[model samples]
Target: MTCKSSTTPVMGIHLHDIHSMASKLETLTKNQQLDQNDIKSILIVIDLNPEPMSIDDELESSKLTRKEFAKSIKKLAELKLIDWDFNW
Candidate 1:
C-alpha cells in the first residue's frame, strides 16, 4: 500500500506530485503527452493526468473503474500517447 518510490522520482517526476494532482486530474486521462512548449495548455495538461504511471497503477489511481481506463491512446488531436515501461 506504499508508493513504490518517493526519493528517486521517475523521469524527474515524483509520485507525490501525481498523488496531489490525483483529484484534479481524475475523471480525465492518464499518461498525458506534453513538453515545455505545450505546458501552457491547461486544458490538456490539467485535464489529463500529467503523471506517468504503469498501466496497473494508473487504473488504480483513476476515478474510472479498472475496466474503463483505456491504455495506449493512439492520439489526442495531434498528440500521441507517451508511455514508459519502467515498471512504475
Candidate 2:
C-alpha cells in the first residue's frame, strides 16, 4: 500500500522493511541476550509505525497490553533505538 501525499509519493513501511528490521533485531537480540518478549515488542512497534509514535497511539495500534507496551517502550528507550518527542 502507498501513502497518500499531495506532492510527493511517500511509501509506507513494506515487507522488506519488516524483514530488514527483524534481521537486525535478531542480531541485536543474540548479542544483547534479549528475551523473546523484548524481540516481539520491538517487532510490533516497527511493524506498526515507521515514525515515532506517541505512547498512547502506539498502545492503541499494537496488540500489546498497557504494561507490555510500557515495558517495550522503556526497553527501546534504553537501547536508544527510539527518539522520544513528547510534543509529538
TM-score of candidate 1 on Cα atoms, chains taken together: 0.23
RMSD from true fold, candidate 2: 10.4
Model 2 CA deviation exceeding 4 Å by range: 1-27, 32-61, 85-88
lDDT of every predicted structure (CA atoms): 0.33, 0.45
Clashing pairs for model 2 are none
Error of 1 at 14 (Å): 1.6
TM-scores, all models, native as reference: 0.23, 0.32
TM-score of candidate 2 relative to the true fold: 0.32
Error of 2 at 31 (Å): 3.0
Model 1 clashes, total count: 0
**What digit string (tens of lDDT, one per residue) describes model 2 on residues 1-88?**
1112222322344433434444556577668866766444443323344457644565555554555544444444455444333222
lDDT of 2 at 54: 49
lDDT of 1 by residue, 17-87 (tens): 34333333333445463453432222222123434655456555555443232221212221331332222
Error of 2 at 50 (Å): 14
